[model samples]
Target: MACLGFNPAKIRNQNLHYSKPSSKIVPSSKPIKIKPSPSQFSFKLHCLKSNSVSEAPLSPTEPQISEQEEEVDDPASELSFLDPEIDPESITEWELDFCSRPILDIRGKKVWELVVCDSTLSLQYTKFFPNNVINSITLNNAIASISDDLGVPLPEKIRYFRSQMQTIITKASKELGIKPIPSKRERYETVYQRHPGFQKGAKPFLTLDNPFPMDLPDNLFGEKWAFVQLPFSAVQEEVATLKRTFTFGASFDVELLGIEIDDKTLIPGLAVATSRAKPLAAWMNGLEVCSIEADTARGCLYLSVGISTRYIYATYKKTPTTTGEAEAWEAAKKACGGLHFLAIQEDLDSDDCVGFWLLLDLPPPPV
Candidate 1:
């Protein structure tokens, strides 16, 4: 019998033939190039595929697998798009071109007429005037009528009135070339009197009392004076310039002793003492009595070292003395009586030296 079984080589060749033929056959239909609409594409690709593909059988026409995915990505497609409500160009036009309406020019008009014509603007205009005149608006029937029509609060309207009066006062003062005097709180406090006295039978050296008597002396000779020296840094050149020129103009003669640094000293005093003196001088306009006679050789460059000192000295010199030098000397002795005395020494340590001594006479009673 002829062998019914096929040859092993032929069978193997036949299996290979079947596989090659299956892969090689060209598909009859061209790929249906149906582009998906955005909504339809999104629904199937995202929602439906995610939900039904896991369990339900896919349609025969649908692609079973994704084609070769792109390796390179487009960066522009990743960015989100935004829409703004306002047009930038329109905004520019509005700012540059728009003028809503015209406002009235009511300069030099009566307050009532101004209030009546434009109640809304009346309060603002009144603020430019003084309170006294503004207060008078209540008596004006036209102003009252406007206030009633506008339903403005009575208190607010009164405030406008007060503001008007204040404006008037300010204007008058400006016109008259008179500076308005500041209220008491704004004014610097004056040194009315300074008296030093020991408690009855107390040791004078242990306790130094400031003997500023309220009673005006008949003569202001040999009165105690204080000198405050100001030391400024080189960085404060502007302040220093102001201090030198405008500070001591004809309005008031200020004695400028000289400038010093933080390290420099007026006399044999602590660096802190000289520093303290600067602020004191600034506050007092450098007023003080001459402690020692002006000596060009001993670092005492000026007669006295402060603007305040200069003013006090000048004032004292201009005022008349009731008692002569002899009586003044006696009074000085009386003032210094019982206090321990130390000789004035320039080279002495700051601790060893006594406090500064000034011969300032009390001013006579005001007539």
Candidate 2:
């Protein structure tokens, strides 16, 4: 654009050293692409209505505003105020900062949504509800109230449900005694002690082997396979990477190993939990549900370690202990205080693998 009140030829000649300004009008044979530099050009835009021109690169003597103009303030610079009604289920500032999950009453032939949100199971229900209140008692009542609706025992799962919801029948609403499911810390200690390989570490400072597993007296070729729990922080990345590594057709990965195994027969296998921040549901008899906070609970938490070739579910906490489970569970409950981190050793241990069998009975989800 030509600068107003200035000669176009003189300005073009001054700015473009390559182009010569001619008295005669001429068209170029080739298409010309010219991009003007900002600093080299100065222009004024005049408003036809106001008869005012805004000048670029104004001089010190130039006035910023005219006598006719009024100063205006930016509307965005001011803060906006709102008086929205607070949500009833929303957690107040005084309330504890905790997550909650929706109570899904699955006991009926058709699933029902409960009004109350169980904070313990809530973090898992974020996918379903935008906001929820955290109250376990309401959830407990919801499950207990549904017993009349339950006709036949549920397929494989509903029959196994017990912990907080275990009554001969669920119909009795009044004085519904909701038993406390074991806290995360207690469950881990109980499971760890009941595990034969981990029994040595139950009362520490004992002569537990370097691998820490105690082979059974009758069993030959004691299962060397074990597990080591990493801090819960790495659970997401490790689980994601594990899924990729264990994808079908993927080969043996030495990167996943806890220790180097020299023997060709001793190969390693691993299973990582996917929920890093997610609350895992600890199903009690398929009725009462307790929320197991990630990394805090021992529900299905297992990651394989050690020099074993065959994969076995023996080390898995889901299995009933070979011995003394009831006693360990009782003692662990007394010790729990809502916080725990397991003893760390470079070499973790696992049970000795025994001869296998085909699957018939599907294991129930632990509390």
Candidate 3:
């Protein structure tokens, strides 16, 4: 690490600071402690569901309740049956995006819009408001309008990605009795083209030009690191192996992203071994890790996380050997549709991995 030739002080100063709401703050000055789980972190894909098996069949000696009788026995069931509005089962969660768009109204002022879509991407509700009227009261009204529509149900949870809009969005969601989650998923783009700005063939207004990669905190750096990979056939087996032992880090179903990999496909990865595995893994658990990219020109590795934030993971002296690996890693990542992994361990020989993240380089959201 000493010979990596990177200065933490310079990296920190070079970082691009993003603004968040002042009313609420997430304390990131110290490592976040997360309760360890057996499998791993997940993006909570909707395509997967857990099946619960009945523990035991009903005994013949026990009283049998007829389906009709059971409905009559429960008073709450009567009220639910009587009401035809708001089928909660229709939508479990909604992805929301509230931001300024490139389009301007007739008055020539910036237009602000609220977009809401269900997890299945089948239903959407969009409402536009002038800049002056953007607030929790207005947002709450817009959501209520959607819920009041015939057969449209209010979602149990609402997820929004932009941290800058957290305060107002959280307020609106709470007022509507929906749990608000800050997530980094880009599912909101499904309805982007429907926006009026893009309807007339307007050019895309935004592109992700991430800033220079900044070095991670000195203490968090691993003692040693290496580029590694596993055949697609062995990934599930490896995950099952890690589950029986100690493990931490993020993971998601590749099928959730609509990606299909052949058994022979190689999944590129980075493995880091360090004595500070506990804190390093804990810190990574707090991030919405997107992907890792190799910069062979500068002989650096960059990690993209939490919206548009970028960090310098490692740096090495440029050479034919290192350059070849870097290019190969890049090619493999592209072949896998940006699917990759990061593993942290106590040491190279240790059987237990402290951290492992299944990262995806999702395409940028629609401008």
Candidate 4:
């Protein structure tokens, strides 16, 4: 699922009102905004299945929104809570920037990236990291299945497959910022997400759940597609990227607060602690992986700076002193790509402690 990237700092202060009685209204010359309760409105989060034929799914060939004109303005718009492709009925403003941003035509492939920007800090990019992967075990399993189907020896195919995997790993490692290819070591680091306290030891995950090069009837080159698997260390692997990592038991909230550098001006900043009564979900790219009170999903550790950039850097100075401190600041690189900032928040009780790296994207200091 894509994150709702509408800048939290821009959310009207009056709209942040929650759990108060109606009589607390403060009259103003400006519009008196009343926040809607969840009981009163629903922002359609997809429909449940029904037996009715009218609720059937659309066929793949069915006419989808034309790429040229993604969203047609609904002439019947009530209040004009306007967005090019956003549903006006959505109580929460959805970021439909992708629908309007120019699509990239790369190698004739229409690459539509989920880009995010904090214009105040001049930081922009999407989290591009590997989540789904077919590892060595999965590759071996695929080879075994394919060889049996094709009446070939698995040994010869394994050698050929290993070579292919090595090639892919070499290229990908450069893009992944893994010093040596993970293909070489049974243990190599990639951005990851997991709870802090699990039984300490190597824990193998995603171990050959489904073999790639699936045995389809028309798939003639199953071996061609099932070339190799990248085996990750089946270890405790407790480390995870702070982009999606959060304090284990702390209930928290996140807000993108525009900071005040002077008496008159405010700059972009993000905060992820206090004023919120409960745990909050962390949004990275389009994925919703962490919650203040719970873990909804996992494996959303990516936070790359650009399309060409690899390696989402979230390593720290120390293992969190307390489990409540999910992130630690070991060192701060002066610059990342064109972005320059300090590790302004870390340790427990800081805004970044709850998983929002708000101050990390600040503009460079005047030289």
| Best by the TM-score measure | 3
Between candidates 2 and 3, name the one with more favorable lDDT: 3
In candidate 1 the C-alpha lDDT for residue 192 amounts to: 8
Please give, for residues 1-367, the per-residue lDDT of candidate 2 as tens digits: 0100100111111121112212211121222222222111011111112111111233688556542231121100111111123332332111011111112112211111222112221111101111232244444343443322322111111211222332322222224432232211011222222221222322221121122223222211122221222222232233344355441111122222111222211111221121210111111112121111111232222111221111121232222331122223222222221111111111122121111100011122111
- TM-scores vs. true structure, each candidate: 0.14, 0.18, 0.59, 0.16
Q: What are the lDDT scores of the predictions, listed in order?
A: 0.20, 0.20, 0.59, 0.20
Residue pairs with backbone atoms closer than 3 Å in model 2 (clashes): 100-122, 101-122, 160-285, 161-285, 161-286, 162-284, 162-285, 223-352, 226-350
Query: Which is superior by TM-score, 2 or 4?
Result: 2
- For model 4, residues 147-168, the per-residue Cα lDDT tens digits are 2542323221011112223544
In angstroms, how far off is 63's CA in candidate 2? 66
In model 3, what lDDT does residue 178 have? 91
Candidate 3 per-residue lDDT over residues 164-252, each given as its tens digit: 77789899999989988776653222323332232344443334455667768765577666666666665655666556664667665
Which window of ten consecutive residues has the lowest lDDT sum in model 3?
Answer: 1-10
Order the candidates by TM-score, highest first — what do you get? 3, 2, 4, 1
Those runs of model 3 whose alpha carbons end farther than 4 Å from true positions after fitting are 1-95, 100-133, 140-159, 163-167, 170-183, 186-197, 200-209, 238-246, 349-351
Please give the RMSD to the true structure for each candidate, in Å: 46.6, 33.1, 16.7, 24.5
In angstroms, the error of model 4 at 346 is 14
Candidate topping lDDT: 3
Candidate 4's TM-score reads: 0.16
Superposed by TM-score, candidate 1 places the C-alpha of residue 132 at a distance from the truth, in angstroms, of 6.6
Better TM-score candidate (3, 4) = 3
